[model samples]
Target: MASALRRARAGEGPVLAWPLACGSTVAERTRAVDFAQGVLRVEVPDVGWRKELQSFAPQYLAVINRYVGESVKRIEFILAGQQLADRADKNGRSTRV
Candidate 1:
Protein backbone atom coordinates (compact mmCIF):
# COMPACT_ATOMS: atom_id res chain seq x y z
CA MET A 1 0.00 0.00 0.00
CA ALA A 2 2.78 2.39 0.90
CA SER A 3 4.67 1.56 -2.25
CA ALA A 4 1.54 1.99 -4.31
CA LEU A 5 0.88 5.36 -2.73
CA ARG A 6 4.43 6.46 -3.40
CA ARG A 7 4.17 5.24 -6.97
CA ALA A 8 0.92 7.06 -7.55
CA ARG A 9 2.24 10.32 -6.22
CA ALA A 10 5.86 9.83 -7.08
CA GLY A 11 6.45 13.17 -8.71
CA GLU A 12 3.76 15.16 -6.94
CA GLY A 13 4.60 14.85 -3.24
CA PRO A 14 5.33 17.88 -1.08
CA VAL A 15 8.05 15.92 0.68
CA LEU A 16 10.05 15.95 -2.51
CA ALA A 17 9.21 19.57 -3.17
CA TRP A 18 10.48 20.79 0.24
CA PRO A 19 14.19 20.77 -0.38
CA LEU A 20 13.74 22.60 -3.62
CA ALA A 21 11.46 25.13 -1.98
CA CYS A 22 13.66 25.96 1.02
CA GLY A 23 17.09 25.37 -0.55
CA SER A 24 19.93 23.20 0.76
CA THR A 25 20.91 25.28 3.77
CA VAL A 26 17.48 25.20 5.32
CA ALA A 27 16.69 21.78 4.00
CA GLU A 28 19.69 20.37 5.78
CA ARG A 29 18.19 21.45 9.10
CA THR A 30 14.71 20.15 8.43
CA ARG A 31 12.82 17.15 7.21
CA ALA A 32 9.60 17.11 5.26
CA VAL A 33 7.49 14.34 6.73
CA ASP A 34 4.36 14.17 4.60
CA PHE A 35 1.54 16.03 2.93
CA ALA A 36 -2.14 15.37 3.20
CA GLN A 37 -5.34 17.37 2.98
CA GLY A 38 -3.56 20.51 1.83
CA VAL A 39 -1.14 20.45 4.76
CA LEU A 40 2.56 19.73 4.61
CA ARG A 41 4.20 18.52 7.82
CA VAL A 42 7.83 19.47 8.30
CA GLU A 43 10.07 18.58 11.23
CA VAL A 44 12.49 21.17 12.54
CA PRO A 45 15.28 20.74 15.04
CA ASP A 46 13.74 22.85 17.79
CA VAL A 47 11.41 25.69 18.71
CA GLY A 48 13.68 28.41 17.33
CA TRP A 49 13.85 26.75 13.95
CA ARG A 50 10.14 26.01 13.98
CA LYS A 51 9.24 29.62 14.74
CA GLU A 52 11.74 30.89 12.23
CA LEU A 53 10.48 28.65 9.48
CA GLN A 54 6.83 29.13 10.35
CA SER A 55 7.25 32.82 9.68
CA PHE A 56 8.12 31.97 6.10
CA ALA A 57 5.17 29.72 5.49
CA PRO A 58 3.56 31.89 2.87
CA GLN A 59 6.70 32.02 0.80
CA TYR A 60 7.35 28.34 1.33
CA LEU A 61 3.80 27.63 0.26
CA ALA A 62 4.33 29.44 -3.01
CA VAL A 63 7.45 27.56 -3.90
CA ILE A 64 6.07 24.27 -2.58
CA ASN A 65 2.87 24.72 -4.50
CA ARG A 66 4.70 25.23 -7.73
CA TYR A 67 6.41 21.87 -7.42
CA VAL A 68 3.58 20.08 -5.64
CA GLY A 69 1.02 21.11 -8.24
CA GLU A 70 -0.59 23.61 -5.86
CA SER A 71 -1.76 20.85 -3.58
CA VAL A 72 -0.10 22.11 -0.43
CA LYS A 73 -2.07 25.01 0.98
CA ARG A 74 -0.50 25.13 4.44
CA ILE A 75 2.81 24.33 6.02
CA GLU A 76 2.89 22.75 9.50
CA PHE A 77 6.17 23.01 11.32
CA ILE A 78 6.69 20.42 14.05
CA LEU A 79 9.57 19.97 16.44
CA ALA A 80 12.05 17.18 15.93
CA GLY A 81 13.01 16.58 19.55
CA GLN A 82 16.32 15.32 20.79
CA GLN A 83 14.63 12.13 21.95
CA LEU A 84 13.49 11.45 18.43
CA ALA A 85 16.92 12.18 17.08
CA ASP A 86 18.51 9.91 19.64
CA ARG A 87 16.20 7.10 18.67
CA ALA A 88 16.98 7.58 15.02
CA ASP A 89 20.66 7.62 15.80
CA LYS A 90 20.40 4.40 17.78
CA ASN A 91 18.56 2.84 14.89
CA GLY A 92 21.29 3.95 12.53
CA ARG A 93 19.01 6.31 10.72
CA SER A 94 20.07 9.82 9.81
CA THR A 95 19.36 12.22 12.67
CA ARG A 96 20.53 15.17 10.65
CA VAL A 97 20.00 18.68 11.93
Candidate 2:
Protein backbone atom coordinates (compact mmCIF):
# COMPACT_ATOMS: atom_id res chain seq x y z
CA MET A 1 0.00 0.00 0.00
CA ALA A 2 1.14 3.48 -0.68
CA SER A 3 2.16 5.51 2.36
CA ALA A 4 -0.22 8.20 3.59
CA LEU A 5 2.09 10.84 2.18
CA ARG A 6 2.08 9.15 -1.21
CA ARG A 7 -1.65 8.71 -1.11
CA ALA A 8 -2.05 12.34 -0.15
CA ARG A 9 0.15 13.31 -3.04
CA ALA A 10 -1.72 11.11 -5.49
CA GLY A 11 -5.00 12.44 -4.24
CA GLU A 12 -3.77 15.96 -3.71
CA GLY A 13 -4.83 15.65 -0.10
CA PRO A 14 -3.80 17.83 2.84
CA VAL A 15 -1.06 15.57 4.15
CA LEU A 16 1.57 17.29 2.05
CA ALA A 17 -0.42 20.22 0.76
CA TRP A 18 -1.57 21.65 4.09
CA PRO A 19 1.63 23.49 4.87
CA LEU A 20 1.48 25.06 1.45
CA ALA A 21 -2.08 26.14 1.92
CA CYS A 22 -1.96 26.98 5.62
CA GLY A 23 0.64 29.29 7.07
CA SER A 24 4.07 27.86 7.85
CA THR A 25 3.70 28.81 11.51
CA VAL A 26 0.58 26.68 11.83
CA ALA A 27 2.27 23.72 10.22
CA GLU A 28 5.64 24.23 11.85
CA ARG A 29 4.97 22.42 15.14
CA THR A 30 2.29 20.20 13.70
CA ARG A 31 2.43 17.10 11.51
CA ALA A 32 0.03 14.89 9.65
CA VAL A 33 0.43 11.38 10.99
CA ASP A 34 -2.36 9.53 9.19
CA PHE A 35 -5.58 10.08 7.31
CA ALA A 36 -8.02 7.24 7.46
CA GLN A 37 -11.75 6.69 7.87
CA GLY A 38 -12.17 10.35 7.15
CA VAL A 39 -10.11 11.18 10.22
CA LEU A 40 -6.92 13.17 9.89
CA ARG A 41 -4.47 12.41 12.66
CA VAL A 42 -2.30 15.39 13.54
CA GLU A 43 0.58 15.58 15.98
CA VAL A 44 1.08 18.74 17.98
CA PRO A 45 3.72 19.82 20.48
CA ASP A 46 1.75 19.45 23.74
CA VAL A 47 -1.59 19.60 25.55
CA GLY A 48 -1.79 23.38 25.53
CA TRP A 49 -1.23 23.45 21.81
CA ARG A 50 -3.63 20.61 21.36
CA LYS A 51 -6.37 22.44 23.23
CA GLU A 52 -5.71 25.60 21.32
CA LEU A 53 -5.51 23.69 18.07
CA GLN A 54 -8.69 21.76 18.73
CA SER A 55 -10.68 24.96 18.44
CA PHE A 56 -9.36 25.26 14.93
CA ALA A 57 -10.13 21.70 13.98
CA PRO A 58 -13.45 22.57 12.43
CA GLN A 59 -11.93 25.28 10.34
CA TYR A 60 -9.03 23.13 9.33
CA LEU A 61 -11.30 20.24 8.50
CA ALA A 62 -13.39 22.49 6.32
CA VAL A 63 -10.39 23.73 4.38
CA ILE A 64 -8.81 20.30 4.16
CA ASN A 65 -12.01 18.61 3.11
CA ARG A 66 -12.74 21.32 0.62
CA TYR A 67 -9.29 20.99 -0.83
CA VAL A 68 -9.44 17.20 -0.98
CA GLY A 69 -13.11 17.01 -1.95
CA GLU A 70 -14.44 16.22 1.53
CA SER A 71 -11.95 13.43 2.13
CA VAL A 72 -11.41 14.43 5.74
CA LYS A 73 -14.16 14.44 8.31
CA ARG A 74 -12.23 15.30 11.47
CA ILE A 75 -8.79 16.24 12.78
CA GLU A 76 -7.45 14.29 15.75
CA PHE A 77 -4.52 15.97 17.42
CA ILE A 78 -1.97 13.97 19.42
CA LEU A 79 1.30 14.70 21.16
CA ALA A 80 4.39 14.62 18.94
CA GLY A 81 6.46 12.29 21.12
CA GLN A 82 3.48 10.09 21.93
CA GLN A 83 2.72 9.70 18.28
CA LEU A 84 6.30 8.62 17.66
CA ALA A 85 6.17 5.97 20.34
CA ASP A 86 2.82 4.77 19.07
CA ARG A 87 4.30 4.32 15.62
CA ALA A 88 7.28 2.51 17.09
CA ASP A 89 5.00 0.18 19.01
CA LYS A 90 2.95 -0.46 15.91
CA ASN A 91 6.14 -1.50 14.18
CA GLY A 92 6.94 -3.77 17.15
CA ARG A 93 9.81 -1.64 18.38
CA SER A 94 10.20 -1.26 22.13
CA THR A 95 9.85 2.28 23.45
CA ARG A 96 11.92 3.36 26.44
CA VAL A 97 11.07 6.36 28.59
Candidate 3:
Protein backbone atom coordinates (compact mmCIF):
# COMPACT_ATOMS: atom_id res chain seq x y z
CA MET A 1 0.00 0.00 0.00
CA ALA A 2 1.09 3.57 -0.61
CA SER A 3 2.46 5.30 2.48
CA ALA A 4 0.04 8.14 1.96
CA LEU A 5 -2.98 5.87 2.08
CA ARG A 6 -4.48 5.52 5.52
CA ARG A 7 -6.27 2.44 6.73
CA ALA A 8 -6.22 3.54 10.35
CA ARG A 9 -6.56 6.82 12.19
CA ALA A 10 -4.55 6.52 15.36
CA GLY A 11 -1.45 4.81 16.67
CA GLU A 12 -0.45 5.00 20.34
CA GLY A 13 3.28 4.82 19.87
CA PRO A 14 3.55 7.85 17.62
CA VAL A 15 1.18 9.95 19.73
CA LEU A 16 3.30 9.32 22.77
CA ALA A 17 6.56 9.88 20.97
CA TRP A 18 5.33 13.09 19.37
CA PRO A 19 5.70 15.33 22.43
CA LEU A 20 9.18 14.18 23.35
CA ALA A 21 10.30 13.95 19.76
CA CYS A 22 9.45 17.54 18.93
CA GLY A 23 10.37 18.88 22.37
CA SER A 24 8.56 21.28 24.70
CA THR A 25 8.69 24.34 22.48
CA VAL A 26 7.08 22.64 19.55
CA ALA A 27 4.87 20.42 21.64
CA GLU A 28 3.28 23.55 23.07
CA ARG A 29 2.45 24.90 19.63
CA THR A 30 1.50 21.65 17.99
CA ARG A 31 -0.62 18.63 18.71
CA ALA A 32 -0.06 15.03 17.78
CA VAL A 33 -3.49 14.26 16.41
CA ASP A 34 -3.06 10.76 15.12
CA PHE A 35 -1.11 8.30 13.02
CA ALA A 36 -2.63 7.27 9.76
CA GLN A 37 -0.54 4.33 8.71
CA GLY A 38 3.00 5.73 8.56
CA VAL A 39 1.91 9.36 8.47
CA LEU A 40 1.66 11.26 11.73
CA ARG A 41 -0.96 13.98 11.53
CA VAL A 42 0.01 16.99 13.63
CA GLU A 43 -2.09 20.07 14.30
CA VAL A 44 -0.41 23.43 14.43
CA PRO A 45 -1.76 26.88 15.35
CA ASP A 46 -1.64 28.28 11.81
CA VAL A 47 -0.05 28.28 8.38
CA GLY A 48 3.16 29.79 9.70
CA TRP A 49 3.55 27.07 12.28
CA ARG A 50 2.70 24.43 9.71
CA LYS A 51 5.08 25.76 7.10
CA GLU A 52 7.93 26.17 9.53
CA LEU A 53 7.65 22.80 11.24
CA GLN A 54 6.97 21.01 7.98
CA SER A 55 10.37 22.11 6.75
CA PHE A 56 11.93 20.14 9.58
CA ALA A 57 9.87 17.02 8.93
CA PRO A 58 12.98 14.97 8.41
CA GLN A 59 14.51 16.00 11.71
CA TYR A 60 11.20 15.51 13.50
CA LEU A 61 10.84 12.09 11.93
CA ALA A 62 14.29 11.11 13.11
CA VAL A 63 13.36 11.76 16.71
CA ILE A 64 9.83 10.43 16.50
CA ASN A 65 10.97 7.33 14.70
CA ARG A 66 13.58 6.74 17.33
CA TYR A 67 10.90 6.19 19.93
CA VAL A 68 8.44 4.54 17.58
CA GLY A 69 11.11 2.51 15.83
CA GLU A 70 10.58 3.88 12.32
CA SER A 71 6.89 3.11 12.44
CA VAL A 72 6.31 6.68 11.45
CA LYS A 73 7.64 7.51 8.00
CA ARG A 74 5.99 10.90 7.45
CA ILE A 75 4.78 13.97 9.33
CA GLU A 76 1.76 15.98 8.17
CA PHE A 77 1.57 19.40 9.80
CA ILE A 78 -1.94 20.81 9.38
CA LEU A 79 -3.65 23.91 10.68
CA ALA A 80 -5.69 23.32 13.85
CA GLY A 81 -8.90 24.03 12.03
CA GLN A 82 -7.92 21.94 9.05
CA GLN A 83 -8.47 18.80 11.01
CA LEU A 84 -12.10 19.73 11.56
CA ALA A 85 -12.49 20.75 7.91
CA ASP A 86 -11.10 17.47 6.73
CA ARG A 87 -13.59 15.62 8.89
CA ALA A 88 -16.45 17.71 7.57
CA ASP A 89 -15.31 17.14 4.01
CA LYS A 90 -15.25 13.42 4.53
CA ASN A 91 -18.79 13.65 5.82
CA GLY A 92 -19.89 15.47 2.67
CA ARG A 93 -20.11 18.85 4.34
CA SER A 94 -18.92 21.91 2.48
CA THR A 95 -16.23 23.95 4.19
CA ARG A 96 -15.38 27.55 3.42
CA VAL A 97 -11.70 27.10 4.23
Candidate 4:
Protein backbone atom coordinates (compact mmCIF):
# COMPACT_ATOMS: atom_id res chain seq x y z
CA MET A 1 0.00 0.00 0.00
CA ALA A 2 1.13 3.55 -0.72
CA SER A 3 1.81 5.61 2.31
CA ALA A 4 -0.98 8.08 2.98
CA LEU A 5 1.62 10.75 3.57
CA ARG A 6 2.97 10.23 0.08
CA ARG A 7 -0.49 10.26 -1.46
CA ALA A 8 -1.41 13.45 0.31
CA ARG A 9 1.80 15.07 -0.84
CA ALA A 10 1.29 13.96 -4.43
CA GLY A 11 -1.74 15.53 -6.05
CA GLU A 12 -4.67 13.51 -7.42
CA GLY A 13 -3.85 13.49 -11.13
CA PRO A 14 -0.14 12.99 -10.74
CA VAL A 15 -0.76 10.02 -8.47
CA LEU A 16 -3.80 8.55 -10.21
CA ALA A 17 -2.94 8.87 -13.90
CA TRP A 18 -0.03 6.42 -13.88
CA PRO A 19 -1.97 3.44 -12.58
CA LEU A 20 -5.31 4.40 -14.15
CA ALA A 21 -3.82 4.49 -17.63
CA CYS A 22 -2.19 1.17 -16.77
CA GLY A 23 -5.64 -0.35 -15.98
CA SER A 24 -5.71 -0.08 -12.22
CA THR A 25 -8.37 1.68 -10.16
CA VAL A 26 -7.35 4.98 -8.53
CA ALA A 27 -7.20 3.53 -5.03
CA GLU A 28 -5.72 0.22 -6.04
CA ARG A 29 -3.41 1.97 -8.44
CA THR A 30 -1.66 3.76 -5.62
CA ARG A 31 -1.49 0.67 -3.48
CA ALA A 32 -0.48 -1.89 -6.08
CA VAL A 33 2.09 0.11 -8.01
CA ASP A 34 5.58 -0.43 -6.65
CA PHE A 35 6.95 2.77 -5.20
CA ALA A 36 10.22 2.72 -3.36
CA GLN A 37 13.40 4.74 -3.10
CA GLY A 38 12.26 7.50 -5.38
CA VAL A 39 11.16 5.18 -8.15
CA LEU A 40 7.69 4.13 -9.21
CA ARG A 41 6.98 1.07 -11.35
CA VAL A 42 3.72 0.93 -13.27
CA GLU A 43 2.38 -1.85 -15.45
CA VAL A 44 1.25 -0.22 -18.65
CA PRO A 45 -1.54 -1.70 -20.76
CA ASP A 46 0.24 -1.84 -24.11
CA VAL A 47 3.21 -0.89 -26.21
CA GLY A 48 1.41 2.13 -27.62
CA TRP A 49 0.81 3.57 -24.19
CA ARG A 50 4.40 2.87 -23.25
CA LYS A 51 5.77 4.56 -26.34
CA GLU A 52 3.54 7.60 -25.92
CA LEU A 53 4.25 7.93 -22.25
CA GLN A 54 7.95 7.54 -22.80
CA SER A 55 7.93 10.71 -24.85
CA PHE A 56 5.98 12.53 -22.17
CA ALA A 57 8.00 11.22 -19.25
CA PRO A 58 9.87 14.43 -18.56
CA GLN A 59 6.70 16.44 -18.39
CA TYR A 60 5.07 13.80 -16.22
CA LEU A 61 8.06 13.73 -13.93
CA ALA A 62 7.99 17.48 -13.43
CA VAL A 63 4.32 17.44 -12.58
CA ILE A 64 4.73 14.56 -10.16
CA ASN A 65 7.69 16.08 -8.36
CA ARG A 66 6.16 19.53 -8.30
CA TYR A 67 3.00 18.22 -6.72
CA VAL A 68 4.63 15.77 -4.36
CA GLY A 69 7.34 18.23 -3.32
CA GLU A 70 9.88 15.45 -3.68
CA SER A 71 11.94 14.06 -6.49
CA VAL A 72 11.10 10.68 -8.01
CA LYS A 73 14.06 9.77 -10.17
CA ARG A 74 12.51 7.18 -12.43
CA ILE A 75 9.23 5.79 -13.75
CA GLU A 76 9.43 2.23 -15.03
CA PHE A 77 6.65 1.02 -17.31
CA ILE A 78 6.11 -2.71 -17.54
CA LEU A 79 3.89 -4.59 -20.00
CA ALA A 80 1.37 -6.06 -17.62
CA GLY A 81 -0.48 -8.54 -19.83
CA GLN A 82 2.74 -10.11 -21.08
CA GLN A 83 4.23 -10.12 -17.62
CA LEU A 84 1.20 -11.89 -16.18
CA ALA A 85 1.26 -14.48 -18.93
CA ASP A 86 4.93 -15.23 -18.27
CA ARG A 87 4.28 -15.60 -14.59
CA ALA A 88 1.28 -17.85 -15.14
CA ASP A 89 3.19 -20.08 -17.54
CA LYS A 90 6.04 -20.48 -15.09
CA ASN A 91 3.52 -21.39 -12.40
CA GLY A 92 1.71 -23.93 -14.58
CA ARG A 93 -1.44 -21.84 -14.85
CA SER A 94 -3.47 -20.82 -17.87
CA THR A 95 -2.14 -17.70 -19.59
CA ARG A 96 -5.44 -15.90 -19.45
CA VAL A 97 -5.59 -12.15 -19.34
What total of clashing residue pairs does each candidate reach?
A: 0, 0, 0, 0
Best by lDDT: 3
Q: Candidate 4 versus the native: TM-score?
A: 0.53
How does model 2 fare in lDDT? 0.72
Which residue pairs collide in model 1, if any?
A: none
> Alpha-carbon error at 47 in model 1, in Å?
0.3
Q: What are the per-model C-alpha RMSD values against the true structure?
A: 7.8, 5.2, 6.6, 7.1
Error of 3 at 44 (Å): 0.5
Question: Candidate 2 — which residues are off by over 4 angstroms?
Answer: 1-12, 88-97
- List model 3 lDDT by residue over 1-97, tens digit each: 2232223234767777777778899999899888877998999998898889988889988876665543788889888889888998999997785
Superposed model 4: Cα runs more than 4 Å off = 1-32, 82-97
By summed lDDT, the worst window of 10 consecutive residues in model 3 runs over 1-10
Q: lDDT for model 3, on a 0 to 1 scale?
A: 0.79
Taken over the whole model, the C-alpha lDDT of each candidate is 0.77, 0.72, 0.79, 0.56
* TM-score of each predicted structure versus truth: 0.70, 0.71, 0.80, 0.53
lDDT of 1 at 86: 52
Residue 8 accuracy (lDDT) in model 1: 43
Worst 10 residues of 2 by lDDT: 1-10
How well does model 1 score by local distance difference test? Answer: 0.77
- lDDT, residue 30, model 2: 86
Lowest lDDT 10-residue stretch of candidate 1: 1-10
